[model samples]
Target chain A: MTRLITILIATTLLAACSTQPTEPDTTLYNRLGGQAGITTIVDNLLFEIGGNETLIGFFADTDIDRFREKLIEQLCEVSDGPCEYTGDSMAQVHADMDIDNRHFDALVTDLITAMTEAGVPTGAQNDLLARLVPMHDEVIHAEEHLNGDER
Target chain B: MPDRKTRLVTLMLTGLLAGPAFGASKILATSGAGSIEGAAGGGLVPWAVIGGYGSDGEWGAAASLGRVDVDDFRLGTASVLAGVHDRLEVSFAQQTLQVEPLDAVIEQHVYGVKTRVAGHLIYGRLPQLSFGLQHKVNQNPAIATDVLGANSASGTDTYIAASKLYLHALFERDLLLNGTLRYTDANQTGLLGFGNSGGEDPQLVGEASVGLFLNPNWAIGAEYRQKPDRLDAVDEDAWRDVFVAWFPNKRVSVVGAYADLGSIALWDDQQGWYLSVQITN
Candidate 1:
């Protein structure tokens, strides 16, 4: 029993270490065609998302203008630019909203649309989304918590 | 390093794959208009194929089995559904409500028709709205006092009007919201006693659900389902649930959910877990 437990603990630690997140790449900035490209993608994405009646319910009380500006600033910062994002953490902002997977997926759809509209090309869109994919782990936690505790 | 270029190539390939994932497809919740994947008890949700034909000419089908246990009574539902011509769907179900010594079973068969109303730019940029209607022909009334040594109960006839609004790019992935209004005037649906007949008004139930695909075959959804209590005696609480489904391929999908079953017999407003699996070809 002791040997089995030790092996299990060691395996768990190895798995966790193997999946460690790497630092955001600086090359993404150049690949995204700098600030202008990020701005265009955000603009197109917001249009598609805001126009959706079901999805718009999530941002019903949000200030679209302010939200749009924040997105641009945040995207610019993440792409290795000089800007700093002062917005709330993704988890904290969406925590109390009962934002389920549907909402999250909808936002993802909007993001993809924005990329398409901006002519970022499929290759670049996929690259950007790969970086954003990890955020889904933090942003989508309600169901995880609910199911995690279920006996 | 070579590793860096390889990573970049991998990222580009993933991005290319994501576009096809967002193609034209409506995201219907696990329980929007069909079975709650795998939950016990039975109401309106159909259990069968995904209700639409895919890009291929062949149709698909799905099945779900679920059970609800409260006090000494248990209610279970097993259903199968199939799609044809990318528009029509037909399903059949057998539901059993067991009360220890006595058992009551209701059988339901459904036929549905749907067609895209328009795909033009409606008031700017709405991709398209599909209109559909479904009729449920039910049978096997096991509640007749003369036959089962129990009180008489009436049967029901129901019709569902459904609409699917397909929008690409409201979210990072394309999204679809499906809304349905159900009207049922069956004599036995509410379990009213003998000679009661149809004294109550028709049930006006409304359902709204949103579905988004993380990928073509994987979707996450949430739905709000509300059905008023037409009968004065029974207090039928409005029901709601959240579900996630995995459609591994075109013909098969599985669903699991946290469901609120309202009230039945003397169950404490049944709230618990549900699971359903469907197969289509």
Candidate 2:
């Protein structure tokens, strides 16, 4: 009876663990189609955002080529690729930009559109978006001015 | 002539149409259509996602109508939900179950509240987690007690759900996964009533959904919901469904599914179609 109970408990524990979703062994960078794919996606995303009137104002004074390179590097580093991002920290880059949730969401939309057009798998696109989502706190600074006097 | 329910639904539809179109802030398809219980989720399972496009300090509301027709039974539900600050959601739902041949009608009033406890579905390493409670009351206690052998006319279900959107899981598609643990004594989702004459305890059950986004607006998924077997009169089996959902725009969504409800009220193999339409602001 004791031996039978031990087997039953082991089987139940294994079944429970098997029900949970497991992460894949492959890194996100490789899943995102590597360097060339990332470049194409970033280019397409920037192009789409550049054409949008609502977003073009944010990039008007920025250097297109340098910005593109920095974005590619940032994405590569974030995805665990063989590249280093030399760009400024997210907080430092957007400190005084007055970026809000609206602009951040718009950029994310453009990025998703670009990834979709470039045939980046939906899973990879979402994975990348998940990593970038936490940056919203560092990037959005509209409330700072609203409570300026209090601080 | 349209009945009072029809007129009320029409008025709500008109209001939804006239509501201002807010800019879509949340990711498309992130705020899923209202579930049968009036919470933001899939057809039957309530996901951890908060409803609407509302984020912090914002408010949003949604209305939905759903119909599930099986071999022996038919269920119709209408619900409205409001979300505050993307953290708390409160909702109301009315369900009507129609039994064929016997032509018995069971009605239920459900009031639900869910709060996002932690994490972000798309942005964080931790999966989105939420706590939800649904208080359900059967309109006719005599019918419930006599036909279903229920001990009470009302019950409350409490659930904890965790949801995660896995970017690029299969063939480059985004996958949305959710798991829920619920404690309840409700029979037939509370349409029949709570507990039974068997002196059964409130059972803990599991529900899960796995969805693959074909695009930003479309998703295909499957769900499994475990149920309790309390009444000795008839056996209740688990419920499962394969579904497709379409988001035509930010304000409107439609879902169609094939569901297997198993034995319901002595009828077996209760499998058929499920359809729902939702409008949000």
Top candidate when judged by DockQ against the true structure: 2
lDDT of 1 by residue, B40-103 (tens): 1122342222352231133434454445444444555555544443334455444445555455
Query: In model 2, where do residues sit more than 4 Å from their true spots?
Result: A1-85, A96-104, A114-151, B1-3, B198-200
Chain A TM-score from candidate 1: 0.70
What tens-digit string does per-residue lDDT give for candidate 2 at B1-281?
A: 23466467657867977987454566677778878888999999999988876665567778888999988888888888888767899988888888886788878888999999998776657989999999998887666688768888889999999999877565456789999999999887877678999754699999999887766788777788999988767778888887879997778899998888888877888888899998888
Kindly report the docking quality category of candidate 1. incorrect
TM-score of 1: 0.48
After the best TM-score superposition of candidate 1, give how far the Cα of residue B151 lies from its true spot, in angstroms.
Answer: 12
Compared with the true structure, all predictions reach lDDT values of 0.48, 0.80
Worst 10 residues of 1 chain B by lDDT: B36-45
- DockQ for every model comes to 0.03, 0.21
* Candidate closest to the true structure, highest TM-score: 2
